[model samples]
Target: MGRQRTKPAPTPPTTTRGRRTRDGLILAGREILEQRGWSAFTPEAVAQTAGVSYGTFYTYFESRDDLLHHVVRSVAGEMLAASLVSPDGVDDPYARLVESNRLYLRAWDRASKVLRLVDQGAAADEALRQIVHEIRDFYVGRATKGLRRLQDAGLANPDLDPRLTALALGSMVEQVAHARSAMEEPYDEDTVVDHLSRLWASAIGLQGAPDEGWAARARATAGTASD
Candidate 1:
């Protein structure tokens, strides 16, 4: 019978020198993750890139997964923080959508390579998949909160589901973020943001005529008169 051995708890960075070394590892991890993706994103690679020994890698992170988690979290935070779609913000629904989409697009553009790698890497690895799903859930949850505000304020269509609307709209923006450059004629930031925001607004009846509104009423009236 034998006892299993585990790595000791990592020491927290307290001094300036310690913090600089830790920060360097994190930066190297992010660059490696973006450049080479899952298979090549190793703690050894990070430590080497950071100009530290393999033993030093473990002083800050518990495992390769931990380092990747920090890198992904950092990227996601930057992406979300750029958007101003707080439920408490005073911006009108349409304006909020526009600003959020605009900033989100810009941030996503900056990290598109890593995001695209995340998409691909997640498909191949279970751990990476979990990270991707978690990030998406957080983004969708925030979006749903914003939509709830619109619904409560009588700005959104009564019949639309806020959570589902957020998921769909957020997915639309994600697709736009990933595929805009692939289009035959790539659109500028303002045009793309405006169109996507308009679509989001129209989806919840925020900026578009409702299906049961005057337009539908007019069509029904014309049909009845003709009959």
Candidate 2:
């Protein structure tokens, strides 16, 4: 009797080569968004940049929108993760808030082009809009929790609605960071951080608290600017 034929093993959905190819495509897509803006970004361009066939690009991303969504999620996830790292010796709630905002601004500055593309894409696409809102809500949620803790500790304003205040402050920082990054005239990073920290502290009723570190840095920055 002839030996029965053996069935071959099924191919894995995520092999090493597949992951490399997928990551290359994401990196290429980010580059395209940075150099050409969202309007000019296309699957073909991403494939060319990634040095992969157009078919390979489709094997990973269904469409440009899908690719954009992935890219936004990737960068935003990294930013959020980085922002979660507590600064050394920073026990004050206000200081922690300032540090988190500083980390976020730095992250936004690093990925400003991709973020801008995401912002632009959200205007016309429902999927992108959802992604944008998801990112915003993630930050706002964290802010809300932090504010609630502060209020419970009798630090933040008792009358302020934590959720609404979080949303408003988060929006203010997001818009200001985006605008400052887009400005032709370079803004002082120290000054922006100092002022924003002070504003947030004041809004949360922590204005009179000792923020000596921030004050010292701001003073040094002013002295340097004046010299």
Candidate 3:
């Protein structure tokens, strides 16, 4: 009888060392983009900064755009995490909205540079543009839910469409945040927060007078975050 053929061994899974190398490359790429902007970002520079060989970069990322895609996703994840706020204890709808807006602004400020790069890259690449749209959809969904809750509670305008209003609010906030974060002129964070919160309150038809202390609370929260 003929001897049975042996099955080949399964390929090894990625080891801790390989994972570390990939993470290092990604971190290095982010640093490069943050310090030198997208114009100077390159796979070679990232590999060199990460102390990994050029071939190692290929082992993880297919191309420069692939690496950048990972970076954008990572930054977007951070922004999403930062934007999440629990309004359980906050009794006032308008106050909750203020806190939510403040958190969004802080997240945007933290990731402003990377977000700008994403915007530019998205404009030039379809894949990147899809990623940007996904992020926008996430924020819009959150806004829609919040508005719906307000409407149910009789705090928001009953006639307004939640989804449409969410889209408009999201677009306005994102553009304003991007512009303000990039401006060279020093601007007060509290003032911006106040203006945005009040605008949202008015647009949503929030009941009762706007809380005058929301800006101070937002500033205090921001200070704590920085510390």
Candidate 4:
């Protein structure tokens, strides 16, 4: 099976007044998601934020979950655009890997709050968990395709399964970035990008794979894993 395009966001009302009201509700929902997260995101709260009657929210959206479907996908579209890199332009495999990681990390950092919310909320909330799964599948699908392309061109490791490798590496970077989002202290962006790029490039048998100091990445494993 191949990847499918993401469905477009729910269209706003065609009339000027209707459009304004619908757009207002979406903005309110987005503000809540970005500021307070899923726990505080109620249909009533959204209506209040948008200065509309509670029933009016329903007129614009079928339910809270329905509104969330639109709002989250809208935000996800921005993240997707931010992370996009033109593979055709980069001739050097290492440079392409580094650029890809850099763009992804940047986009992830911007949505750290929403990412954390989705990750932590997924366990208890099935409806909310779909947001996390959708995001994951979208990224993984693109990455798997990219990996297969590299392998076909003999630029990546032919020994590994592309989908499995995509899942593993995707999880690796996402987990690290999720953890970093929790810290108050700022990290060295350039250093993190270069380090992560090496891990992906090295794993895929891309040229200039790191030869040493790679296994020493477990520096915090003993202490961190216990927590």
Candidate 5:
């Protein structure tokens, strides 16, 4: 033979279940974060937990950070969606803020490790930093817009700065999440939500503890729907 022929490598079979496999991996990764923390996370661990081969993990993600990127995006999406857009829908500013605070607490409680990993990664990786920033900016933009609306409607003080308020609220949420992650004490959801609501309320110029009716209602509804 004057010439030799070479065949291309065969493509790996992955997620014969398609998106379900990737979704399963993400779910498994979240479970790992919750159970083992970031220090214990690895591709091998997640693959074993997901009941998929190591090759399968690579098929869905290039690396551990890649899988974590997906998890953080999903968590951020859920948190943003749960934010209150209008106080009128909740009866008052205090109620609305409390509800929003509660939602943030729930998201943070479940995603604390993921959030911490994102922060740590962002410190070293430009791409990850940008992704984290985009996620924060999206939430802050929505909050600023919502606060502007409240101000225009006379629910928020006319003299209040929406941008600063948005940043303040975001900081408050992140700080509480960081605190919970640092502590080993088992505080319940209601306790966390109550404290978060008070923090947010006091930051926005509210004189006392915020009304928690909206938060209670949202928690009850979320529980019922999940059931």
Candidate 6:
């Protein structure tokens, strides 16, 4: 007669301390991306920087590239979040655009090292490049929607093409943000905002652009309570 086989007990779930350790490793890798740039990154360095065992690091992530990917994606998400939210809310669309631009400038100031690494890596890595493009595309779509709103409110030129203009403006802002990182002396916050704001204003120039009256009207209508 054959003996009945017994199933082994399931492996125990990971502990809170273990999860915290893994998160610490990821955080360490992110700090390297910010401070040392991707060129100097290594998993061993991350483990040392994190003060975690190498085996522990591997338990959460497969390799250095995996860690890099996670770091880049995280930083990209942070930038996107800042870029998407309007500090002034919906009261003033122009102010909202200006505020969001300033936010991007500030975010890039802190994230420049990571941004540069992603920019460089994207050229050689298809997945990285796609991620970069996806980030930019998100900004472009938002700008396009804003431009469309401006047009609807008679704040932008009705004849102007929103899609092309949005892409061009978004590209200009992103390039300027990246270029700011390369400067030996960082430009003042107001300087960046004024420069970008003016560039956008001129691009849609007042003859065909929204005047103060249009903005006032929009605000007035927008502020009125719904019946």
Candidates by TM-score, descending order:
3, 2, 6, 4, 1, 5
TM-score of 3: 0.83
lDDT of 2 by residue, 1-227 (tens): 11222434223247888888888888888888888877667888898999998767767776777788878887878777866746464886766766777888888888788777777768888977887888888999988988888888877788999999989888888888988988743667777877787777777776445553576789999999999
The residue-by-residue lDDT of candidate 5 on 118-148, one tens digit each, is 7877888777788788878887887798778
What TM-score does structure 1 among the candidates reach? 0.76
Query: What overall lDDT, based on C-alpha atoms, would model 2 receive against the true structure?
Result: 0.78
Better of 4 and 6 by lDDT: 4
lDDT of 6 at 195: 73
Candidate 4 off by > 4 Å: 1-12, 184-186, 209-227
Q: Would you list the C-alpha lDDT of every candidate in the order shown?
A: 0.77, 0.78, 0.81, 0.78, 0.72, 0.74
Candidate 3 residues lying further than 4 Å off, grouped into runs, are 1-13, 87-89, 209-227
RMSD of 6: 11.3
lDDT of 1 at 79: 73
The CA-based lDDT of model 4 is what?
0.78
What lDDT, from 0 to 1, does candidate 3 have? 0.81
Residue-level error in angstroms, candidate 5, position 152:
1.0
- Candidate 5 global CA lDDT score: 0.72
lDDT of 6 at 149: 80
Give the TM-scores of the predictions, in the order they appear: 0.76, 0.81, 0.83, 0.76, 0.71, 0.78
Clash pairs (backbone) in predicted model 1: none
Candidate 2: residue 11 lDDT (0-100): 35
Task: Residues 80-192, candidate 1: write the lDDT tens digits.
Answer: 67664566764555666777888788888767766676677688778778878887888889889878887888878778887898899899888887787435347889989
Rank list by lDDT: 3, 4, 2, 1, 6, 5
